[model samples]
Target: MLRRQARERREFLYRKSLEDKRNAIQDKKDKLKRALDENKIIPTELRKDALYLQSQLEFDDKGAEGVTTYIDDEYKWVGVDDPKIMVTTSHDPSSKLKQFAKEMKLMFPNSQRLNRGNHEMKALIAACRANDVTDFIVLHEHRGQPDGMIISHLPYGPTAYFNLSNVVMRHDIPEVGTMSEAYPHLIFHNFSSRLGGRVKTILKSLFPVPKEDSKRVVTFANQDDFVSFRHHVYKKPDRKTVELTEVGPRFELKLYEIKLGTLDQADSADTEWRLHPYMNTAKKRKFL
Candidate 1:
């Protein structure tokens, strides 16, 4: 009985320590945020310490908005003219992932799932350069769910990394490919953070980049509590039969992070993007 009590006391102490550590971290972040909101400059000695917090704050403030790095500086329409996009999963040859890529290709006929030679980001970029491929999406999956994605734009770019949740496959939606769609509009909701930056990357791949600076906003929203994205198709009032066909974002993205280079710098980019590891569901939560 005494030993059990001692163990319980130790566990309580450990939990208390963890809670205190978390609270201290939160307090520091709150202080930094307040200072930023008030436009107060930190002392030089403290600036180094606040740099990380300031960076995170700045990241949140813009959330991939106004980032033009991905825009083609030379051709301006590398992927837009023909819109050749390549989709490939991680090196692990998961048949389901390959099929998912195929469905993605069917959804956008211009896109193709590379059967061979799509291992590293650098190799993918080289292949794209050779094949005139302008955009590419690399999906990192965990237990069949595409938890993360690396979106790259060609000919000088700003690649964007994204987090995906509640992913619904094309096959899951009944008669998805068989049903017809008439250019359904994209509905973005509550997309915060570098999501705007990533949105440009996605749009450039699917369509053409906007030529002029026009004040337009497409916020990402869908999740109940957090930011999300959804695709809605409404039947025209004049139509008797429901179009019987619809389309969605294919998958929702959180635009968790952004970077300046392409697959050429994938290693460092992965680190910056916090690349999700591929593993079973339980293992993923424990390690990845």
Candidate 2:
């Protein structure tokens, strides 16, 4: 009799808990309905229509979808190998973009080559994720413009670049003294001819004008010079604070010239300059 009574008591508690949950959910639904009804009762047709003499506001038609909160799948593209350089001819790219791609292809000739297609890209991305591949190169062709700008979108939305190091470096590079001082004139060129509107938009958003302007230009140089420059940018400083070090007198170096482009293709000239005096002012160790 005691065991049977205990079972009944447990069953009663379980039913009561479920009933409580149902009541709470119903209460929330009722509250939402009430608020919705309150909003609905206000008739827009009854509102006064007044024409006040306000200053004319000009709005640019640049397409902007209001802030979106996107949901993404759990899978990530982390272990992909470094992207290989692939190339295709484009009439749309600027001269700079074509030249850059040609150079990259020479360096990585065997990298996979494929035509540009959204479906193909999506499939490739899925394959890359499944195969633990984080890096691969796609050479897209444009009319006469260089594809450099198209490269920007490879790390967008659901296709987020899992590599934070590049992101951080890209963010921090312009702030370093050399690039920082001349930063005002830095105009980022879509050196690759395959730029798409989506890629262009993403780049513009990240390095917004009158703010984080990317003015650095990529010039072709001997492999040695390129290697040296990369080392300077990526290298870690040796010592933090050493006693009586034979250090050269500190003078900020503006490593690169900065420039800007106008909307018109004809007047799109690079002609801006600035100098950073704080390039290497920090005595802190590179690692630190």
Candidate 3:
């Protein structure tokens, strides 16, 4: 099993490298095609190979517009199978954090909550892989307040790290009835950019496909890089009226980093993306 896994990883990396080259060529082809269509000068770098790329463009078709990347491989089975998620807290978590982890488990259908105990990260990830868990989430706390979240896609990954704030668990809300366990319809607002789209895919894969008539809804709204999470259930009282009720466990997530490997390989994984808050344009920039 170990040898097979290592060989598969190597094959995936090799394919990813080839995909990167294809994407670069596709980008150049796009630029050349645009310049020609607009009757403008071809870029200096592409002038030498303009004819070759132009000839290659003739072979392109609508079906081949976007080349598949490693991201496609990562989520190839997204809609086909329900994601199996494992939710756990940091080692020796506080009571509040434990409650938060439970709520998270309830949030994602087909998810299981596990006790952290004294298990090492490596061993925990191994167990999850053995069980065929699709995603593993670790909630962290600071002084008894949940403040961090790490979501790692299993087998192979593109782990996302987020700063959690304003967490309101179900236990904290009075009269918040039992949460719904049905697959939820997702609403993602303001995730327009490429990076935003990437983040959206990561978040969306957590939940399975919902039925058209499912009343449960989960919203991830982004404003100035902070994603506010809200859960709701709706009903139609009359022909023209709709009633909505807010479910418990609301929170905000700010992405800090995305690594291209599982949690256990954090030290060796390549950093896919990371927030730079100290940059001069940090205040003016908006990421998702």
Candidate 4:
């Protein structure tokens, strides 16, 4: 099993490298095609290969124009299969953290919470893989306050690390009602940038498709790089009016890092992106 996993990882990395090359070429082709269509000068860098690209463009069809990337492979089964998520807390978790993990489990349909009682990270991840878990989430806390989250996609990964803040669990909400178990509709706001799109894809894949009439809704609204999470259920009184009720367990997440490999490979895996809070313009720039 170990050998097979290692071989598969190598193959995945090889395909990802090829995908990068294809994306670069596709970008150049798009630029050349645009310049020609607008009757403008071809870019100096593309001039030498303009004829070659133009000839290749003739074979391009709308159906085959979309270039597939490694990301597509990672989430190929997203819509087809309801994701199987395994949620766990850090070792020796506090009672509050455990409660938070339980709330998280309830948030994602088809998810289960596991007690991380003295279990190693590698063993936990191995068990998840063997059980065909689609994603592994580890919740962390600082002095009993849930403060961090790590989301790792299985088989292979592009793990994302997030800092949690202002968490309000279910029981904490006044007069909170029973939680809905139906798959919830998702709302993503202000995820416009390239990195924002990548983050959106990771977060979006966590939920299964909801029915049109599903009353439950989950929202991730981004502003100045902090993503605020909200859960709600709505009811329509009159044809023109709708009433919304807030479900419990709302929080804010700030993405701080993303890795190209799973948690176990963190030591050697390439870092895709990381927050640089010490930069001169960090306070002025908004990533998402």
Candidate 5:
């Protein structure tokens, strides 16, 4: 009887010892898992298998079908990687458009003024091709107002024509200062879909984007050389031709160019050029 009791006691202790060891190992595993999770020590690529970084993305599919926004996808206009532009104005010597073209060339990084304006479009395009000019911006003036513009990208074209309003000039600025020859960084604002994404396509002719990673210092203030462009377009639906009454929706484009530097900076007095005040107020203010 004594032997039997001793054997039973020994068996019970052996089972208890095994259970304790298993419990210790499981606790260790739990602690290790918690540590790995907290430290983010896992490689991101490896974590992708577990869909770790997926929370940073957005999915915008399944939108309503019939809602029409006149906007388009990102606009694309491919031109020479190294842009070479020929700038010109109307043939009229007295045309203010010529002066506008001169100042505009300064805004572009690498561009030149044509020796003379060519009235013939086909001949002008041929001349540009011969000169290896990738694109051109032609300023058109009517009477005295600088009212029209034409931009053509070489080879294949999404050539664009525009009618400008509230056009302002350097001379118009009451207190304009001499500008450094720094190539101005350009800012394009408020050109929506109805503009056929022409702003970007047109700008690409001036500032071509690189194929690889592009790092740019677009963060300069008005003191630094930078240019801003604003454009607005209004289109009305066709009414009965006899009635001649117009009906449609309209939109606004707001563009402002301020000297790039902070107000306290001595060099920040950029030529004060802006759209006419009447152009802005007259649209909203009911006629007196």
Candidate 6:
């Protein structure tokens, strides 16, 4: 009798466990269904409003065709003729700068910007400008010093200077005022001091310079300059290898730290420009 009772108790425990698992699965399915329904319903009204608003906006714009108003000054269009270069600088094949450049070109198809310029960028810029170049779209990040001694494998055309340290120091902004405040000291620590050492090591390993030490001193620049050097001067670190390290200015950091859930009407370039945080979400966040 005791054995039969024990057997019945065991059977009851097994059935209870099975029932709990079945209920849990059912609960999950119900939750998913509810979530899907909620998503579908929430977007439906928003979609209708957006479509109607967009059509109304189009009609308004069409109605004001060829009528120049005072408001037109605030909405000046960036003419499609600017010569811009889309630079992607990094050791990584899939860097954010590269992706941003690709997307930017897609969005503004008329910009005349290349990845990197050959030889002295200043010289190139001067030449391009003399030939009626109005604008340049370069990676703002590449405006600084690069990793290693040799800025790039590109050749410097005589008076061309490769090192951006010279330019950086010449900037009117103080260290405290610049983006250097946010990053660690490891970036610019040995930059000025070890410039000679780094250049020697890079040249010995990468390219065999025909000129003396003085010539080499003038040749070393930042990453983009280095890549340009390789392209125009040296022949070692191929076009694929040369890269700009930093992204855009730290202003993005300042803007990103704002905890506002909704943007104000005055906070944007246009009312038509909806805030799609997808790109921000896609970017790798260094800070929490």
Which one wins by lDDT: 3 or 6?
3
Candidate 5 lDDT: 0.46
* lDDT against the true structure, each candidate: 0.55, 0.29, 0.91, 0.91, 0.46, 0.30
Clashes of 5: 7
Between candidates 5 and 6, name the one with more favorable lDDT.
5
lDDT of 4 by residue, 1-288 (tens): 989999999999999999888789889999999998999999999989989999989987878755678998888899999999999998899989989998999999999999989988888888888999999999999999999999999979989999999999999888776789889999999999888999999999999999998999999999878899999988899999988888779999999999999987888889999888675366545777
Best by TM-score: 3
lDDT of candidate 6 at residue 123, scale 0 to 100 = 48
Stretches of candidate 6 exceeding 4 Å from the true structure: 1-94, 140-288
TM-score of 2: 0.22
Stronger candidate by TM-score (5 vs 6): 5
Q: TM-score winner between 4 and 5, please give it.
A: 4
Order of candidate numbers by lDDT, starting with the best = 4, 3, 1, 5, 6, 2
lDDT of 6 by residue, 133-221 (tens): 32333333342333211112111100111222222211222331212112111111122333333333322222222323111111223
RMSD of 5: 28.7
Off by over 4 Å in 2: 1-75, 80-85, 92-97, 103-148, 151-232, 241-288
- Model 1, range 1-288, lDDT digits (tens) per residue? 436634754564455457667567656767888777898876455466797766665545435564332132423464447667788777774766777676666544367787644466666677686787777777777887667777776644457677777777656776543422233233454334353434544553554333233222223453432345433344545647544243433566555555645667655533334334452354322211
Alpha carbon lDDT at 262, candidate 4: 90
Report lDDT (Cα) of residue 168, candidate 4.
98
lDDT per residue for candidate 3 within 1-288, as digits (tens), equals 779877887888788889889889999999999999999999999999999999999999988755678999998889999999999998899888888888888899999999999999999998999999999999999999999999999888989999999988876777676678778999999999888999999999999999999989999999988999999888899989988778879999999899988999999988989887575366546768
